[model samples]
Structure formats: C-alpha cells, structure tokens
Target: MSSVWHARCAGLMITSLALFAGTAWSATISHAAAPAAAHSAPAAAAAQPAAPTYQHTASYQAAEAKYNQIRALQVQAFDASECIRKKDCPSDESDMLRPLEQALVLKRALETAASAGDRDAAYFRAKVAAEESARFNEEADIYTGFQDPAYKRSAGLAYERAVRERDFAKNMLVAGAIDLHPWSCMLYADLNMAAQPGVNNRDAAFNAYYCAASGFADRGLKDLALKAYAGMLKTGHPQHPYVLDMHSRLLNVRPDNPWRKIEPSGLVRQPATTSKTSHH
Candidate 1:
C-alpha cells in the first residue's frame, strides 16, 4: 500500500478507537447510574468531582503556537512525499527536507527553553523529535525498503532523545503538580517501543510493554492491558523472572482470571485473553 493509504487508514483507525473509547466510557457511566441516583443532587455532584483545569503560562502558550506551526509544515511535507510517491503531482523530495530542517531549528530552540526549566517546551521538543524519527523511518521504508542503516540509526537516536525529553517533561510537570493524561502515558510507551526493537533490545522492549500494559489498566482498559501482557508472554522476549513478577503484579492489581496463575516458565497458565480494543 502507498504511504498515503497507510496514513489514511491510521487516521480512520484512530477515529474508530475514539468512538470505541466513548462507547466504553458511556457503558461504565450507565453501570454506575443506579448508585449515582441513590444520592441527593448535591451529594452526587460532590461524589463526581469536576475535572481539574490548568492555566498555561504565557511562555508555554508562545511555545505551543510555534509547535503547532511546525506541525502544520510537517503535515505538508508528508503530503508532498505522498505526492511524489503517486507521481501525480509536481513535487520535489526537497519539499520534505525543507520542513524537516525547520523542525530541527525549532527543536534546538525548544531544547534551550527546556534547559531553562520550561516543561511545556520540553514536551513539544519531544513531540517534534518523535515525529522526525517516524518520518525518517517512513522515508527509509518508502524509498530504500529498510536497506539503509543510516536512516535506522538516525531514527533510533531521534526516538531515544524524544524519550529522554518526554521523561524530563513528565518529571517537571509532576513536580509542578500537573497531572498527566492517559494519552501522555501511552505516548511514552510508544516512544519506548520505537526506540527499542527486535531481539537485541529485549529489556527495553519489556519496559515498553510493561509501561503500555500498566498505563492501559490504570486508565480502566483492563482488556487492552491483558492483550499487551499476552503479547509479552507469547513473544517470550522478556526475562523469565520479570515476566513472572509482572504476572503476579497484574493478578494482584487487576485480578482477572487469565492472570490468576503463572506457569513455571513465567507464562500465564490459562488461555490467552482477548481484547475487543481496536488500533491503527
């Protein structure tokens, strides 16, 4: 399939997942309707606390605006690349490189701000690096079919930097009493997975899967978490002891039947748990 098609499919899948999440959330609210109705109006309002809001600093707002502009250029670059692939539009590969260079410039500026303790800049910088890394990988796939080691190495380094910046941002935000949303946690897991790949990075892969599973569970997506755990066990990529430890932890915290017991080899004894969750 063309890269454009893949991008379209991914967008569609994301939309579907959003719908699914909304449906699941509605179901959860419905299940609590009876108990919620038992309380008086004021008591019910108190029980269901309002969502907290944060005020962004002026510096953060300025940085965010620049980030948005950079992202728009990045999307144009992607479209240009796709046009080249189709051979249906007058496009130069240089069209793609120009925006990437701009992104790098912005990334450097953000780095400076991040060093001065700007958490929002740090987050935007991580996002730019991650997207740049993904674009590098996509270029290699579309043009060289993974035959270029330089692209792979560059992608890996960019992803690694993204993870570092994102971690720093998270720490800074937490210290400032800012709570991270579930999507932020999921993005961290994605960065980890992108940074570490295949058998050579088993420990890193384990960390990625562990992060993903735990984040999903904490977000009330236990079924998705179980699927992540199942992928870990089926691959047998992680250390046996670590797998066993994770199994035990899941059983204690989530308490699902599939994680009820573990085998000597650290594999779940029960049948594989399935999730209805869809992904791009």
Candidate 2:
C-alpha cells in the first residue's frame, strides 16, 4: 500500500476503535435536587419516568461481528504495510488485498441488514462506504501522481455514493444510537467539510458540532465539549443563539466551568488573511 493509504487506514482504525466501546450513557434527563416540602417529595419521585432499555437485535449482532472481522483484517493489512515500509519483515502487497476483499463482503452484509431496518447495520454500512471512498481517492492520487482529472473524477463519484450512504444511515438513526456511535457525527462532519459549501453546510456543521459536543460531554470530557460549543457560538451562524443557550445551560448545570479560564490565545488560530498585492 502507498504511504498515504497506510496513514489514512491507520488513522481511521485508531479513531473507530477508540470510540466503539459499548458503554451506554443515561437515556433519561437528569434534574438537580431541590429543597422541597416533606409532603411533596413522594409525589416528585413518582413523577419520574423509567429509562428505556436497548437490546441489540440478532441482525445488529451479526452485522457487528462482520464489522469487527473487517476491522481486524484492516489492522493486519496496515501492519503488513508498515513492515514492508521498514523492510524489517518480509511482506507481500498481496497481504493487503485480503482486507479489501473482506471489507466488500462485509459491506454487502451491512447493506442487506440495513435495508431490513437495522440502525447499527446502516451505520456500519455507511462507514464501510466512506472508507472505500477514501481508499479509492488515495489510490487515484498515487496512480496518477496527483495530476489526472479522470482518476480524480472517478474518486469523486465514489465520494458521492459514500455521502448518500451516510445520509441514509443518519436518517435511520435515533439519538441513543448516535450516542453509541459518536464517531459517526465526526465522520459526517468530515464529509460535509469536503463538500462544496452551500446553505445546508451551515446546518450540517451545527448539527455535527452539537452531536459531537454531547458525545464528549457524555464521556465526561466537559472541557472539550464546552470548547466546541464556544467555537460554534463564535462562528456567528444563524444557530448562534442556540449554541449560546446550550453553553449557558451547561455552565449553569456544571458550576466548575473550565471554559471561563480558557484563553483565546491558547487555541489554534486561523491563518491571517492576505490581499493579492501582498502575495507579490
């Protein structure tokens, strides 16, 4: 495999593995306890609803198994590529083909399961398609030495398909599923960033930020989540009010706000804009 291909595969694999843990966050809303009259305590307790439960179905389980298999093969391929690069262990290019082939088979299984209304399957299918698109684009870059329009066009078509698959999967998902697969939000964000900017881009960006921020918060990365929300608010998008409201609520609920102490100078800054005359 090419170096670019290896890097992309390794990066994505690490991210997926890190975020795929089965820990579930609370599905019910939490409220602060308040000092109440003794008589009202029992009535307040009775008013709370039971949290809903989620059980993975047989199809979802099967699809998950297949997805795991694909990930394992990808790891093997990535290892082989690294060994070949170092020339420390004998590795053949053919070793990488196994994972690519298995991934395609897994994609088909995921597609079938997704069509049957399996939300997890839909998510996995979208991920597979996105990976395939990345692979195609990287391969095209290598094969053409980054100069061939035809190859780029072919890769672009694959990207379009990946986007469609991602959207389909997103439509099938619920909030709980999104919490379980927070990486999906980041994946969607990447796709939107790559897309040509339009009216939808603003909403898509906000949704991605919101979902990812919630995911981070659920995982107890409150500072990271707060920073994301703050950045969203700074964008001055039409959704600024909503971002501000969320930030305010987060601070209200968590009094030990780290975001207040964070300085703009510590964050990454955008490159300074330049005029055409300055370039000369």
Candidate 3:
C-alpha cells in the first residue's frame, strides 16, 4: 500500500511541472510581440518624415517682412525718379526734387502701379513707403524752413504761449500754418520748446512768435497768422523788436479798441517808395 501511494504522488508532481512550462512559453511569446509593435512605429517614422514639409508661422511673417522692406525701397527709388522728371523742386539745377524728398515719390510709385493694373500692390507699396518717408519728411520739415523768418517767428511765439497753456499754448503759432507741410514741424517744435527753461530760451521764443504770426500771413496763412499774432501779444512778446512796430500797426487798425486806421496797415505804411531796411 505505501509503494502505491508513492507512485501516485510522483505522477501528480509531473502534471504540475507540465502546466508551469506551458504558462512560461505563453508569457515569452506575448512579451516578444509588445517589443515588435513598439519598435515598428519608430522604425517607420525614422525612415522618412511626413510628405509635406513643416513651417512655423514665424517663417511666414519673416518672409513677408523682408519682401515689404525690399520692395518698398525699390518703389521709393522709382518715385524719386518721377519727382526728378517733374521738376517739383524748382530751385534745383536738376529736374528733380531733393534726393531726400519722399512724399511726392511715394505718390508717383503708387500711380505707376495703378497704371499697370496692380492696384493691390500699389496700395501696399504706398503704405510701406509712407512710414519710411514720414521719418525723412518730419526731419526735413523741422529743419527745412528754419531759415525762413515766417517759420522762425511762429516758433518764437508758440514757445511763449505754451508757457501758460503748458499744452494748448503752442496752438497759437501752429494756427498759422495749418495747411502747410513743413509748417507742421515748427508747430511741433514750438509745442516742445515751450517746456524748456525760459532763461536761455526766451530769445528763441520771441523770434518764433514773430515769424509765425507774420510769416503765415505772408505765406497766405491768414487766419493762422492772425491768431499767432494775438497770442504773441497776450504772451508778452508784443514788445519784441520785430513785433513792436508791427504790433502797434495791428492795434491802431482795431475796430474795438477805438483805433480804426492802423492795425491792418503794413508795418511800413508809408508809400511803396520808403527807404528799404538794410539787406543783411
């Protein structure tokens, strides 16, 4: 009986070993498939990138920016050529305006593009050219007419008026050249100079005021000049040498202050044959 029991126990142990071997074989097959599946995707990806190349949005903007800058410069050159042909700067020996002159050039380029049926291109060109041109224009306008008495006189007054107004005071001089191109710079200058110290700045202020008031008048800035003149008087620049006799003329012609015969009269009210001021 004991020997029979031992043989039965040995048979049970063999059956358990076979079951464990089958499970181990199955686990090995399953793990091998997982690695193949994971590796296949990477291998395919490494073989080649997707069909369409990738580009970030920054690349697009960068390309556009470069094109606009280069094309705008080209168009600007073309416009300047046209301005040369038109003799817009009549004083120059060449048929062209100053090389730095830009506004007219930009407009000319736009017209050329429009004539060629490239209205969209013309529009974009004008927009870009204007930004570049404005910088030059602002610079020229500021320095352009400084030598002219009208502009200088206006600046003188605007600086003084700005003292009290601090903000609105400059309007006194700018009022004279509302329609002028170069006039705008002096107006801005007048506005800015008002904030400067009055000690060393007084002479300049007086000069600008007189010029703005009188210059605009001569330049046909009639209304603008009148306001500039009035503001100068109110701001205490009326006694400035350039303004003294002129201011007196304006007062004498006034209808409200009892003087009727003098204000509108020219500073030199004598016959046109009066002795001329020295030509410095």
Instruction: Give the per-residue lDDT digits (tens) of candidate 1, residues 153-239.
Output: 765665555455545544433322223332333344455555534525445445545655665556556676776677567545556
* Per-residue lDDT of 253 in model 1: 62
| Per-candidate local distance difference test | 0.63, 0.63, 0.51
**Which lDDT tens digits does candidate 2 get at residues 22-120?**
222221212222334544777886888975544555865777788888888888888878777775667777887777787678777777777676666
Cand. 2 Cα-lDDT: 0.63
Q: Can you write out model 3's per-residue Cα lDDT over 84-118, one digit (the tens) per residue?
A: 56755434333233333443464455445434644
lDDT of 1: 0.63
User: What TM-score would candidate 3 get against the native?
Assistant: 0.26
Candidate 2 stretches with Cα past 4 Å from truth are 1-65, 75-98, 141-186, 196-200, 211-239, 252-280
Q: Judged by TM-score, which candidate is best?
A: 2
- Model 3: lDDT equals 0.51
Clashes of each: 0, 0, 21
